[model samples]
Target: MSDRKSSGGAFLIAAFAMIPLLPVASCVSEGHAGGAAAKATGTETTSQPTHATYSCGPRGTLTVDNFRTSVKLVDPEGESVDLPASPATQQSRYGETPYALVLDGKEALYMKSGKEPVTCNR
Candidate 1:
């Protein structure tokens, strides 16, 4: 019984570790959806380098009135990147939409509607 419990505990720990990595993909993909291009700017050690970490996965895909955004990547350390808002893109969407951010050297990307990031659909 003890052995089984240990195995279950180990499995739980492993599963939790994977949770953070999931978001990395969303941040990168979101940039592509809006026609905003992003490349690796550089890398920094520690979580403080970027403001927040965003990644691509089920939680990263966000949909609004006529547009959707996905996160394709984000820094492993949970850093945030800022992209300048494009007037043309916002106009097409009907208002001033927040720009998607990919941080941690493109390891994560996040889709933002305003101040908060839009959650992924699934």
Candidate 2:
């Protein structure tokens, strides 16, 4: 009789141990579905033009494109090459425009071929 009781207790402990695992398994499955859905929807976008900036160590110089989102880099001898974004684009909120380059962290240097960057704050 005591042997039967011990066997029943063992079964009960095993059942309890498995109960917690069920939720964990379900959570992992649901997380995978969410990730797949995000990928299939193609809902991601970026605000920066493809020509924002391209930094290749201290050797490459990026030439701004018409759209400002794409860039072509000039090599040491002035050879040009296209550059794609290293990482996927990130979302920017309301006040999130890329500022122009700064020499002393206080200058904005975004300008066109015949234009100059200006500061006009009231």
Candidate 3:
């Protein structure tokens, strides 16, 4: 019994760890008479990135809206900055100059022009 419980707990922990890596797929209906089963409901499936928030300690919080090809950052001042993926870099890096962001799974490295690089987590 104890062994079974440990296995179950391990599975739960692993599942939780994968939450950030999961892509959020949304299916939208055209509001037709049929609802995805009548063969004419007209459902469109779109994959959207999860909106993640990261705490940057004293620098304040950042809300991220990742769009696969690009990422939008909401700064502490409620300003939104959109950054396209850097094709030059192999990693999932974005932006340049005044703002640069590098994301690795659930953790992110944010760098600004005059400040030190800050590590952020969701």
Question: Which candidate has the top score in lDDT?
Answer: 3
Q: State in Å the error of residue 101, model 1.
A: 24
Give lDDT tens digits, candidate 2, residues 20-47: 3432443454465787547634533333
TM-score of each: 0.21, 0.22, 0.53
Superior by TM-score: candidate 1 or candidate 2 = 2
- C-alpha RMSD of each candidate structure in angstroms: 15.8, 23.9, 12.7
What order do you get sorting by TM-score, best first?
3, 2, 1
The TM-score between candidate 2 and the true structure equals 0.22
Worst 10 residues of 2 by lDDT: 90-99
Q: Which number leads on TM-score?
A: 3
Looking at candidate 1, what is the lDDT of residue 78? 43
